[model samples]
Target: MAAEAQSEGGLVFHPLDQFKIYSLFGENPIQWYTPTNVTLWMALAVFCIVGLFVFGTRGRSVIPTRVQSVAELADGFIYKMVEDVAGCEGVKYFPYIFTVFLFILFSNFLGLIPGSFTPTSHIAVTAILGFGVFICVTVLGFVLNGAHFLGLFWMKDAPLVLRPIIAVIELISYFVRPVSHSIRLAGNIMAGHAVIKVFAAFAPMILISGIGIVVTPVSVLAITAIYGLEVLVAFIQAYVFTILTCVYLKDALHPAH
Candidate 1:
């Protein structure tokens, strides 16, 4: 819960409280089996994806419905992205990439709803996604290329003396991919939501104090602007995450420079 303090002006703000996770059940210590807001939102994202692909387009028709059209567009979009970024071999992995895209896309859009939770705003959720992709690509690279997979970090183009230094830097960066990947998504989502919440808090200023007249209108305008930007950011972040995954897959499939 958001901590609140009373003052002479009766104004307060705790924007970060919206991201807190709490069990659906009574107040108790969380466990693996506990159902939290994160679980609810993640499940909702999955259901939305299934609904769009399965039920939304269950009936194949010559003249498609709006939902079917959207479904097709999304499918084609991801397919082309995979093929273009990772090449034809990566097409075989399109389903995995598409699934990740849908989950993140849906979660981001859904989180924009009032009073709803954003699973992507949490590091735990994003870390799982980032690390899962990292692990998958690493294993696939080795399975497909054997010891040659190490080529991903080796810099043969550099001069003999600089090769080892470049390789060491590349090796560290390779391991850091998951950390950077996960934090990028979580940090952006959290920052946007927190900023929105801060503006929302000021929205009530008009009713609380005399200085609120100016604060309220500015806050509302800021909130509106930020909200619009956030809508775009929601899609861009998903696209970035998915495309990066494709890039990683491309590296795995062809580890050679």
Candidate 2:
């Protein structure tokens, strides 16, 4: 009966609430802050990026070590993505795109650690990332294309009768970018983690039941496979975010195209 109850409970899905503010300053307004696991993950993400780049580049060797080779591969991957999406003209923006991708990727992967929180799973983090891309694209659009970029929203070149309708739709889409971008990342990470947690919560139960012993290996294997999948997802999401930024940059450079 206990085994049955445990098995049943294992099927119950519950989300772990990991968000919390860790500090408040009574004496110093500037020091008042929300402490969260998210913040730690973000810090770690930044550290990993800096460490990898520094370590990877330090040797400057003709024949690279495995670590250096891996780093160079990552660098080249982002560079090629920028070139593909934004064109050769887009190479100049590679730095920002690369940083954004690596930060988000590392942060997402870090959350897969047993106790670490995923910053990208928080709306605040995703929103900031999305907003940064939005602002950069908007600013670059005007700077590079001048008044011509206004056509992106105004539909000035549209047929005289269709201009107003087209502009309205374009305007709506423009405003939706940040919200959609942020939500997509947050939703994906949150869902992935939730699923993994659900599976993990089942592992022990399956091990404890006499019947569960039969299923224990299967449950363990499932967890292992899903974890691997989540790792892949981390990279894919980062690539998607970075590539989208490149696409936006291209729009900024040539809105009409």
Candidate 3:
């Protein structure tokens, strides 16, 4: 904790520092085209998705291998989700929803590794995803339903005096969907990673200092508990995001529903 020791001892925590974006290569200024940790992890996620789903399932058999079985299971799960939430018509966009879920799920799991970046933790990434859903659904609604899409905002069932207020509230909530959607994913992802990092910072203290013995076990236990929870959260967040997307698509496809 002294000026000389810097990060050496006495519970000097730097949890958020783990989320810093930087290039893997060196200490150079990043450019628009610069390949950073985010790009690396995103590409790795994509690679894993393809390798597991594509190559792993290439050999179709009467009795499926473990990898093929997993691929098939995931496919079936999301396929059913789209159909149930967005209806049979929404099944056409299965590939998009599946890819989004896979990428986020993989990004989250990869981040649990000792030295890995989580692309989904960044607002920039999540915002793009959130806004993309917003824009896509909004456009699809307009395209499919034309002016009738505005019925989503109008609350005809409400009393005559309250219908205008309800419409206004619904319109605002609809427009705010992207912001809320993006923050939900990014906040959940960032908070979990930051908690793990905080616990991990304490583990190093025991190796060189007297206070480590007490802190190390606690840190390890906390990390393990949170890590296991994060595993569940990873899938849940992916599922929530995808299911919500399906719901929005349903609204777009059938605004009155």
- Against the true structure, what is every candidate's RMSD? 1.7, 4.3, 2.2
Best lDDT goes to which candidate? 1
Q: Candidate 1, residues 1-257: lDDT per residue as tens digits?
A: 23334455565677898999999889998999899888899899889988988998988877988999999999999999999999999999999999899989999999999899999999998999999999999999999999999988887787999888898999999999999999999999999999999898889888988889999999999999999999999999999999999999999999997
Give the whole-model CA lDDT for all candidates, comma-separated: 0.92, 0.80, 0.89
- State, as a TM-score between 0 and 1, how close model 3 is to the true structure: 0.93
In order of lDDT, best first, we have 1, 3, 2
Q: Candidate 3 lDDT, tens digit per residue, 1-257?
A: 33434544556567787788998789899998889998899899989988998899999876999999999999999999999989999999999999889988999888878778899999999999999999999999999999999999887787999888989899999999999998999999899988998888788778777777898898999999999999998888988999999999999999984
TM-score of each: 0.95, 0.83, 0.93
In angstroms, give how far residue 54 of model 1 lies from its true place. Answer: 1.3
lDDT of 1 at 198: 87
Please provide, for model 2 over 79-146, each residue's C-alpha lDDT reduced to its tens digit, 9 standing for 90 to 100: 99899889999999888888889888898888888766888888888999999999989999998889
Note the residue pairs that clash in candidate 3.
206-212
Candidates 2 and 3, the one with greater TM-score = 3
